[model samples]
Target chain A: MKHKPRLPQGLLTTGSITLTVLVLFATLPGYASIYTVILLAAIFMYIVLTLSWSIFSGPTGYISLASAAFLGTGIYTSAIFGKMLPLPVVVGIGGLASFCLALLAGALTLRLKGIYFSMFTFGLVELIKHLMLWFEINLTGTRGRFVIVVDHITVYYVMLVLLALTILTAYAIRRSKFGLALQSIGEQEEAAAHTGVNVTLVKVSAFAISAFFVGATGAIMATRWTYIDPYIAFNYLFSFMPVLMAIFGGMGQLYGPIMGATVFAYLEEILITRFPYFYMLFFGIILIVSVLYLPNGLAGLIQGWQKRVWGARYVHP
Target chain B: MSILEAEGITKHFGGLTALSGIGFHVDQGEILGLIGPNGAGKTTLFGLISAALPPDRGVIRFKGEVITGLKPHQVCRRGVARTFQSVKVFPNMSVLANVMVGSFFGRPNTVSAAAAEGESVELLEFVGLSAFAAIPARDLTLANQKMLEVARALATAPELLLLDELMAGLNPTEIGLAMDLVTRIRDRGITVFMIEHVMKAIMCVCERIMVLHHGEKIAEGTPKEIAASKTVVEVYLGESAYA
Candidate 1:
């Protein structure tokens, strides 16, 4: 019988820590205040976005700013179908819609590399937002739509499921042959192609897969809003926040984005509640400091210290 | 018998004709060297055969099948693989992972992870990079990086390999090892089409040599005949000799 490959020690430690935290959070609603439950739900949403964004952009260095486009598509799907279908089916359709949109967008613009790719992806958000706006103004005869509301507990549970799925998918892809192709493409696309990677197909498929998570999260979160307009659904902050969180946490390990999104979301919550007027100013300062000093992100900073303290013998390098 | 053949290969980058009417064939299990002065379109010809760039006019046949207009990855899957003029190893990946990428995706059939890893390890040993398999590719010396690229290309299990300027930046010792590696590769039944600027390495290792000048083929013969050709000496060797 073939032996199963042993998991790396680092991965095992990380996996256990993740499971512990997940179990704690899974039971939090029973004992904690509703405020804590809601806040955790919001944190889960950010984690899903940041983790999914890193799934594609982290390894490929594509720097996509198109999360809002997919998220908004999911929001709209939920708005249109919330009353007709059940929650799970609606979320599935939302994810599928975003996947299709991403496939078309990726195939068209992935040929453009570096900053050009970023610009095109950012432009995709604005294009979709305006297109939805025009459709609402001209054809729908309505500007905003109401969504069917789910209980806060149900919303929290769904968000938890999504967070789990995103983590699992991201982890699985990162350890697979497909993930190696993505990294190779990022390092040297021409060489990767000559080495037998179908660069276009890999790029497009990853783009769509990442979008699936963002879309599903958006679908679940839409129920909490109860009503969403194009502006609310397609906010550009959704596009930028995930990128920042991933960078702040670290892009090196799977937990890097998870750590980043958790800290960033918590900070945002605290700032908005206590220092509403100056929250963004403080948030901006923290982001700048992290970018300037923690070049490798939080995980990298920790890894660096581990190497120094242990004299390189303790580290894998 | 020829394993790879190209005819009437022409490419134009705007107004500059990079390659024009270039015809060549790589005999099975032979090392065919291509040499020329700067801007002779040597790399461009490799690009056309490997499908990195399209030929405005040409038909390329591999194993008696037309492969003209196929994508680079498609060409690779058909058993043709290439290394870039400049080393293009995936810098952030481990040396073994770099080769694994090739073994996993280079073939028509899918490769299991364990099988890919085993093949990658063997290729790394073949290229004398077995000791450095776990280190990131960017940490390797330039010569070692070139060897890593060779290992990666070989992991694709190619029947025909195209190497562009494999010894351009290497020292004399490194060049000797690279030449030895090429011969070893040929002995293993892989046809090698190489572009080289090192006259000694090319003359000693290759059975036949082709010369290009101003995007056109100038001479085609055995290494001895090419060395004795007045036209080649006048245009290429003479310039190098003066320098």
Candidate 2:
């Protein structure tokens, strides 16, 4: 069979423009109220986290559960530096630290395949969290550190810019040689390797890229919250949430994570407001149903539906 | 000097010696045919040379470099590319996308999108798959899938191409087309080494033939020489079948 170019036009133009406008409006000074600003911040953070996770886990199927560990590393590294250094420097340090940590993780775990890799990553997160607790004296002075707040709007804008950058980077990687290599590995590792794709290097590169964004987002997140602790930084729920969002959005597609984050955030808000005790249960059910019926997630389901409709029309005409 | 050489290759699976002390060489741009019975270890030999399996003892030299235990990707980057006996194209991706994968990542450095696309299209055209470029690989027929596999390997721009039973499930017409394609590949200055069970295709296309029995090389020579070998006949027929 021959290759076909099937880029969606709507996604390239109208969808991107609308998203940019919406993000800009949300972060604009004196535009959204303080409460709305907080909500927007939460949504953006989730989107960034989900997109970062999708980079490695979605296309390559590595399924690293160590995202929160790297995120925490970034959060704490930036939080420590932010106390002493400038904000931009702190964010840079966070990205560097997270990237280093990802490299370490990749080196140790790249040899493992499938579920074993996932389990090892999950363990790494737990190990990092405990190590953070053990080294409390040096890291937190026996207590959690806090960054004094001076500019909420500045932080909001920083996040918006970072989110845009993450999306752009993801899009670039998707179309680049590295992206194709990673996708081939995800589809069939042995076959990809036989065809000359350096599987280990590709996986490691992906993990590092994922770490850079997750870490930057973590640094921003710590500043937005004005507090940092290993408990919240290495939260298992945070790691799992991004995976769910990626799966919900459409695994390897560019906008899947964003769509997933938007839906997930809204769902959490609605369910928590109406039935706080049962919200978790409701969320689980929704995820199960989405996976069962739309195994490719929302983006795939929608694409499949569109193809069917169009195919029927062509046949009938 | 031979373009590709294997020296003292051996592999063991627990107590089973899949291959023991096997060695051979292929001249540049030559179509070297390999034939063996089910347990003769032809696939294992391909795996060892291609770096899919590490040999217990052996040295593989491609273009005169010792590539004993390089990883599969490393071997490919060193100008050796291969296709699996079983069809292994990326099923979910479009046929064009599958070939583009080779052009994009087959070499170490990145190729431009236009260049990659052009190369991929040329490969598809060479393999007679230009018409199905936009279709998903899963939608292709068995024969076309095998052709696509060959196209993908070619996109890697390897100096030597290894094909594994590409004609196993192909019809006679498809087999003829594949043989023609193999000849064209050789005409383009890429050496070809293939494993095959179809005697007719091998005899028609191969410059020389290597025969294996019970993981050992029983004979190696031209089609006329290999056909008349006593050991080759013994391996093909059990003692009773030959009698």
Candidate 3:
């Protein structure tokens, strides 16, 4: 009857792996080439994005595509304010702006379930993108707001720290009472309500937390580029890619998004370098095959294999 | 003291009347049986009382507090827990974890995961599902799934437990076990409100019976009185042969 894992072996293993990765990442800039550092920074950005998606949408099955809404809010906040403020302050503003947007969206759409919820969230990004474009043509001239570009190495270290914080926060949430409540809502909203879970409160809080993460990533990344148009800031690519990567890695587990982001980021870099014109086509083909074979994501495939070899002994919750 | 009091409870779904002017009271520690033919408003009545749906007309009181318009979770927090007519276990979670969710969310005194787990294990044992605690709920047999539902519902520590057809697909032996479990639940000081099609179990176990026909309360009495009532027999005969 007592089936509690007194100490979570899976969590411990995940924590140790995360720690090792963190240590290695911290030491990278000392000896690694500038290209390696830049590439890793971009990879770290991807990890933050995918994990942000996973933390809210993965366990809850909400299928939110509102990342660009949050991401663009952050980017534009930084773009408009970066020149007058400190880098950390600008990033904080970006995060706050995105969190505000999430509160608005969660209030309006958290009642929607399944495919309707997905479409509404998908529409949210599009809504933000178009509104920004409209504002630019009607008021602000063709050129978008100017940005303050920080040094690449400083940006790199900041990204590493942000990525670590996002993951640690995500891991902590997955094990907390908040995590359990959201996941219960994910599994069965009615049942969760019946069990005394404050469904609206849990969901709205999760939405804001996820938005804060993506917003911070977007705010920091916005300064790295020379141009800051609505097109660049509110790219649909950022909106959709994190979702796909999280699904690929196994959204069910906390570490799943990290694995997905890492693999896809490197694969993207290699394909762009080698295939140039045909990279997306190759990416599409590879992604299709992986999704078809590993329906539960890469983590699921690994779990299934581990279960077979280990004879199904104490699989993680 | 009455655990539940319903007055003039009525529900309509776009002109289809589900319940109308149905009044009932379930006393503390009473085992009340609810029976009706399909579309007889039994489940609809349950839904209104449990706060899954709001009544078009009437008031529902639980432990003397007006709970008619409360949300389902609010109702649960006030000590009402229910099982679905269909098996509604959290499929991906372990049986123990599934029960733990209820205790963790529904019990104010359970402050830690370990405490919830210990309490949930006890509930699981009470419902005879202790051996399957670590297994995912999806893998359980339907009969055991019913038992798991009871354990999960019990984890809420409800003053009134509304069981929606817990014995529908159960074997005869399983039904016997279920009957015993229901009695034990009452013995543990929880009021029981159950909807059942198994006449033998309902007749033998419930202290009283309420029959609904076309959203109207046509009969309310002890099991033997219900069996002998001409209106009850006529209502069942109009729909189909009574089980």
Give the winner by DockQ. 1
lDDT of 1 at A123: 95
lDDT of 3 by residue, B1-243 (tens): 788998988889998999988999999999999999899999888888778899999999999999998888888878999998988888877888788878888764545777788888899999998899888899999999889888888888899999999899999999999999999999999999999999889999999999999999999999989988889988773435344
Which candidate do you rate higher for TM-score, 1 or 3? 1
> Where is the poorest 10-residue window by lDDT in model 2 chain B?
B234-243
Kindly report the TM-score of the first chain in candidate 2: 0.89
The model with the greatest lDDT is 1
- Each model's TM-score for chain A is 0.95, 0.89, 0.94
Docking class of 1: medium
| Winning model by TM-score | 1
**How big is the positional error of residue B95 in model 2, measured in Å on the Cα after superposition?**
1.0
Residue range with the least summed lDDT across 10 consecutive positions in model 3 chain B? B234-243
Give the TM-scores of the predictions, in the order they appear.
0.97, 0.92, 0.95
Which residue pairs of candidate 3 clash?
none
lDDT of 2 at A27: 45
Residue A126 in model 1: lDDT: 95
Off by over 4 Å in 2: A1-23, A137-143, A224-227, A304-317, B108-110, B237-243
Cα-based lDDT for every prediction: 0.92, 0.84, 0.87
Candidate 3 DockQ, CA atoms: 0.64
DockQ, structure candidate 2: 0.67
